[model samples]
Target chain A: MKEGRETTGGIEYVVGAEKGIREIVRDEDVMPLLESALSAGASRVEVTDSRGGTLWACGASSGNNDSATVERRPVFLEGEPAGSLVVEASPGSQLRLNDLAGLLCAALNKIITNSLKRMLTTEIHTSVVNRTYEELLETNKRLRASESRYRELAENLDRKVQERTEELKRMHTRLIQQEKAASIGLLAAGVAHEINNPIGFISSNLNTLKRYISRFTEMMDFYRAAIEEADKAGGGITEAACRKWSDLKLDFIVRDVEELISQSLDGAERVRKIVSDLKGFSHVDDSKEDIVDLNTEIERTFNVLVHEIPEDAEIVKEFGSLPGFLCNPAMICQVFLNIILNSLQARRQGLKLHVSTKHVDGNITVAFSDNGPGIPEEVRNRIFEPFFTTKDVGAGTGLGLTVTLDIVTAYGGDIEVTSCPGKGTTFVIRLPAERREHVKVR
Target chain B: MIEFDRTEKRMVLKLVFYGPALSGKTTNLLRLHDLLSREGRGELMVLDTRDDRTIFFDLLPFFLVTPGGLKIKVKVYTVPGQVKHDATRKAVLQRADGVAFIADSRVSEVANNYSSFENLEKNLAFVGIDIERIPLVIQFNKRDLSDIVPEADIERVWRPTGIPVFMASALEGWGVVETFSRLVELTYDSIDGKCGLSEGYGLDREDFVGRLTKRVQGS
Candidate 1:
């Protein structure tokens, strides 16, 4: 191996023995001189061409040349024999110059071989490190992609689970609702039977009353003819017949008959209205919503449920002046009916219920207040939750408020409850004052 | 209940065989498959199954083309007998023209038979088929086995329902063809009365029944 060479700033150049040694070292005569000088321990050893141009040298040593004998050897580059020196001893010693030349030649050869090995080792180490770095970068990229994919899958799985959970909850709610409706249907059947009995007799009594009214009218006509004949005849016998008619209290009979006729008409009308309300609340035609008089609906509901209230209990109403709103009248009536029924159940058999309605801020507000034992603080919050009724399981499904809330919410309304434990409970409902555009047109 | 439509000149009817597990439903189908004439029937398609029992359903289709050119296609299907396969039962029960409830004749299987009948009613409702109006027949299979219920007792239990009942040994191929033919005749008569198959489609009752019976009996 040859040592690397660099030139300093100079136009004129001295070709060292190592630089031009390859061309001169082939001379036959100089070969022995080179070998003899290296063997004699000279520090510098050189062989030149016959023209004295520098050829090959070995062990080129550089140092201060002093009075004591000193020698320097030349180094070779690119496998050329260049100038050389031999040193018999160190420059500080008194060794002869020729002896020093041989030692320098051996030293230069060792320097060149060691430099070549170092360069090769460095190059191999750099290549290995570069390849290892590239592999690590590729693996990291794949790992990151796998991580992101797993994250996306986890997110999708979470969303799917949420959707399925919600669907199951909805299905459960619907099942409970169906069960409650079935029970209500059975109860309604019994109630309808109870109502039909009285209605049947009321209708019969009205027909009988009509006959009595006609009979009484005929008797009055007979008396009027007798009186007229008496006046035309001017006779005692006709006048005596008039006095007998008076003595028999015909005036009292006529007045009492008139009063009875009015009372029977009122009774028949009440029965008719009760039947009509029963039919409406039963929701025989339940497929669609209808435009209905809210006040009339409330009145009918009160009539049907009034019997359920205790005799000593009082019901007060503050009905607001408002136009009829489009709604599913039967369902709305059911809402009020359930609330009122629940209030009656909560009362101590003789409590009062106050129902009021008013228009406030473009919304209709209806409030139902009962002077019954108020709801406990713990249960007041969950009263609207499905299946959370305070009544025993068989008596109530606890779905009334939940269903009412659902219906009112579907109609774009909200409900609130306020209660004090010892005082009573109040339920306030706020519904849009006007029907929706679609409902209005329908 | 199933409705039979003879709107097309070809009268196509659907019959469903429903029962509980181990009640000889598949056995009856197999017996019919062996006895029926190959030319008049389509291939019997049994869906994937588990434990030698149907999980989805079994279909055995037969065709009886009358001399009047009216074709009567009878597609017979058997529901999965296990209690859990309700959805599959409902799917097969849809659009059914008639139903044959295969009850196990063994005394121990009576409870399962009634429960399966109730399940049949529920699944029929799910598919909007009226259970009362369909031409329904009940067949008690495995009569050859010991500990079987008496025929008189079974009739006494089911007589009030007003449905025809038959006793059979499906494994021995006894009473299988009779049960199949009775249901076929009822189905045909029902369709004839409703859509006037005989008058409107020029169908002959004797020829139709003969062809259907011969095809089902492999004669």
Candidate 2:
């Protein structure tokens, strides 16, 4: 119970510490009992506090304040010792003052208890009322705030619509970009297919041309030997053919032609490899999930992304042998591309992205670790949220990690990211070694 | 510090016990009441709710006018730790001189403890109390229960806070008095340093704490 509430100016609820005993035990309330006990053949009656501070007494120093004739008992308020009753019996009194003292103590305690209960009830009721009033005030404040917000919204309704319209426009642009990307993939696949046909025939023609050139060289040698034989017989026709061949510079021409054809063959081979990489990227977009050697799929994805990688960037690979896994290779490649590109863009130079693969516990785990400025604490968890980019507007759509998460989760896999703000970030992706449906029931 | 009457030389200091709901805050107060009442100290005034929880606040007050003509009154209060009592908690937390955060010792209540601690920090700031300057202690209650957090692990996590941490079961009444005494001492020291209690009124730290903690009759 709080005590001693003074009307301190500008203070609402200031109180002293002790809920004093005198407030509950007044003289008017206990004087009648004291006088009655004095008439009940008792020589003396008294009431005092726990500290022996007297509140009421109808007794003299009878029995010489003797311990033998005196009876004392503590009074209580709400189960706490608040005061006491001390009754002294003169030697001539026939009544036991101890019994009288007990009765007085109980009576006094009851009065104090009832009074304390009322006080507590009042205090609690007041607290409840104050709490309700405060609550109403809070509610009013909130209502006013929301009403003002609504008014503001109404005043700027057109601006609000325009803002939403701008958002819709950006969404439409993203939709078109996604459609264009898919179409480009299909078109690139078509181009690769078209180029593959010409490359096959050109390669065959170059082989045939090589064989013919060799045969012509052998024929020229045979003719040169016959011409020599003719010269030995002093034939004018053979001598004229030798002079025309020398004038044509046939020796240098033959050597140069062979080298030129070999170089063209090498260039054609490189073109074919590039087309193959393009096919890996594009042709798989529309295909069903392939039973892919995971390592080979990783190699194809990296080969397609080779141009984007910096020339001096160190990429360490720790690829473990893994079993064939079922996944859409194109979608998986997108995940790889997004992660690797994030690593590349994380720093200006000396980027070291460590990619590792391992098979353990029926899952093939791939981890991409980057030596770059890592994600800050505040932004780490939200990095995968769609449209939650830290990059400048139009610089990033922020859908990369979201899409990667979708692809990995769709394959019944999960991704984990661990990063130190100043050191680096690591993204570990785990996909099942085999499709869930293919697992043996036994 | 709640109030100071310069003319009367009276200083009222308030200490609050706060924690998550069912984290043994009121139990600690009850233990204090039980142990302290036996020593003829003040009765524990529990403003108990109908649900048997703290709604407003539980108060146990110590009033003393020292031999040196200075009145130092200490009020120990426990706020309702339930989530819905935010306003009440904030109100009771205002002008608190010290705080003892009673954390649950169960291994499962780590998140609740963390959120409650954050709430304490935020509410302290809301009440215009500087958290760094105020005296604060952490007590992990319910150490008697099974599946409680290991002491070593708790220390490892809370050691860097630089606040004194205690392990106790209020049910057994082991560490309640120690927590109470420490809070009182710290509160006294803080007020003494700032308000010049010693130089102004000859207030002694040991004397003040001894008078306030006189109710802890060892069970």
How high is the CA lDDT of each candidate model? 0.68, 0.76
lDDT per residue as tens, model 1, B108-201:
9989999999999987775667888888899999999999999999999999989999999999888888888888778778777876667766
**What TM-score does chain A reach in every model?**
0.50, 0.48
Report i-RMS for every model. Answer: 47.1, 7.0
**What is the clash count for each candidate, in the order shown?**
46, 0
Against the true structure, candidate 2 has what lDDT? 0.76
DockQ winner? 2
Query: Per-residue CA lDDT of candidate 2, range B3-114, in tens?
Result: 7776767677889999998898889988888776343345677764757877777777676666668766677888888887765677667778999999999989999999
For residues A105-214, what per-residue lDDT tens digits would candidate 2 score against the true structure?
Answer: 77877777666656655654565467667768888999999999999988799788999998976775465346336434544654565566657756776775676577
Residue-level error in angstroms, candidate 2, position A87: 5.8
Candidate 1 docking band: incorrect
Tell me, by lDDT, which candidate is best: 2
Off by over 4 Å in 1: A1-142, A175-183, A186-190, A198-297, A303-313, A322-334, A405-414, A432-442, B1-219
Error of 2 at A250 (Å): 99
True contacts kept of each: 0.00, 0.00
